[model samples]
Target: MKAAILDQAGKPLVIGEVDIAAPGPHEVLIRTAACGLCHSDLHFIDGAYPHAMPAIPGHEAAGVVISVGSEVRTVLPGDHVVTCLSAFCGHCEFCVTGRMALCLGGDTRRQKFGGARLTRGADKEVVNQMLNLSAFAEKMLVHEHACVSIDKDMPMDRAALLGCAVTTGAGAIFNACKLVPGETVAIIGCGGVGLAAINAARIAGAGQVIAVDPVPEKRELAKVLGATHVVDAMADDAAKQIIAISSGGVHHAIEAVGRQASADLAVAVLRRGGTATILGMMPLDCKVGLGAMDLLGGKKLQGAIMGMNHFPVDLPRLVDFYLRGLLDLDTLIAERITLDQINEGFDKMRAGTSARSVIIFDT
Candidate 1:
């Protein structure tokens, strides 16, 4: 099987052969159909996020189940599914509390670490799966918990983004922030994840959906996707613009850029008693600093992992929205590349031009 392996930081991926993995107990082996190139992946490649090198890094994906372990019953071979990072353990305290996204109990549903899920060079080295999916390869040995079956009719390429961008964006509103109708919302960074936040704000009945991005291309695209306003982060006083647009501050400000600056802006533009959801994956050891005095006014800052997604419930709803023509999955895909062209896709993402470049394996 062919895969793109990041063996070192600040390096191009090595496109080469790797041994295909078989399913372990409670796991599933999926034949890769499509995987979206996301900015988060680049963050790891650039060492913004620490990852064991020589790893197959991909998380957002959709594929057909090729094999399943004996204990796997949620899906079977030939079933189409979308993979998510929020693979849950039903017995975890967080899962029992109805916050499955926060499930910390290790996946009883699958094997852990280097269980021969991926290997390279005549099996001399084992490769790690990013977020346990590693859909960058020709196949994946993932916990069955990471995947949820969706309509096979959904273009696999488009369905792949639903695993991360769509779920992160919409679920933040419907799950994490629980945004109310007519609330003013500002989304920082109009990339794949941020754009989803804008579209979700619209679907949630937000009164004002402000799309903030440094790129004009993305700002324009955001309008088409459902943002009511677009603000340039590079512009002077961009935070002030958001505050002005929402008449002092937005009720919900989402930071999807994963930068301290954007995190501060998301906090700064929040109205009193407002919530700011950090939907992006920040670099390890970095913190979003906020003034204690400002926080005293009841403004809140919080982390949202995988949009606090409950895959079984949220994924099907998102798929239905896609089928209903409300969610703009197509609009989010700026380019469709072959699996071999994944490195170039990440380059485009780093350039801040493409929204999302999906690897169309089945195409």
Candidate 2:
């Protein structure tokens, strides 16, 4: 199978062929159909977040089940699926408490060395699977819990992003932030994730959705998706513009760019009692600073993991929303490329030339 491998940090991904193992007792082998190149992948690629060395970086993907383990009954050999990396162990303390996203109970994968999922690559390497799904290649051996069944009719190209971008964006608003209707929101960064947040906020009935970014193209795109206002962060008094348009402040602010500055913007734009949700994964060493005096207004800041989503439940609903024409998945995909062209896709994404470039393995 053709897979993109990253053996070092701050380097371009090496696209090549890799052999994969079959499924285990609770795993499923999926024929990769489409995968989204996300900023999280960039984080791992740049070593902003340390991990096992040789790794196949992909977490947002949708595909068809080619085979299943003996114990897998939720999906069949030909079922269509969208996979997530927030695989839960079902019986964890967090799972029992409804915080299953924090479960880290998997069989402690065997490598201490970075990057080694394949043993035949000469040195018994330990190419780490970014997240658990590792859907970058033509095939992946994912735990059953990491994948969810979606309607076969869903466009695999766009459906691939639901596993991450859309889910994260919508999940932040509906689940983590628990936004109220007619509330105000400002989402910083107009990338795919940020765009998804803008769309979801609109669906949630936000009265004033403010999209902020340095790029005018993205701000325009954000408006079409549901943002009532757009702010060019490079322009003078950007945050003040947000405050002015929103009339004092917004009820909820979200940071979609994985940067300290935008997170601060989300915090600064809040109205009394407003909340802020940071959806982007900042570096492990980075921190957001807030004054003790800011809490007096009952304002809050929180983090959202995978949109605070449960694949088994939220994925199907997301698919339904797309199928019903309520969610705009088409606009999210900037272009489609074949599996062999993945490097180009990543390059385009890095240049910020597209909202999202998908690796379309099946079509």
Local distance difference test values of all predictions, in order: 0.86, 0.83
Judging by TM-score against the true structure, name the best candidate: 1
- Give the local distance difference test score of model 2: 0.83
**TM of each candidate vs. truth:** 0.96, 0.94
Cα lDDT tens digits for candidate 1, 1-363: 888888998899888888866677788888888888877888888887888867988889999998898889899889999999788888878988899988863764334463667777754687777776777888888887889899877888899999898889888888999989999999999988898988888888999999999999999999998989999998889989999999999999999988888898898899889889998877677788568866787888888988999988899889989899998899998888887787778878878876889888752
Residue 353, candidate 1: C-alpha displacement in angstroms: 1.6
* Candidate 2 root-mean-square deviation in Å: 2.4
- Residue-level lDDT for 360 in candidate 1: 81
Candidate 1 has which clashing residue pairs, if any? none
- TM-score of candidate 2 relative to the true fold: 0.94
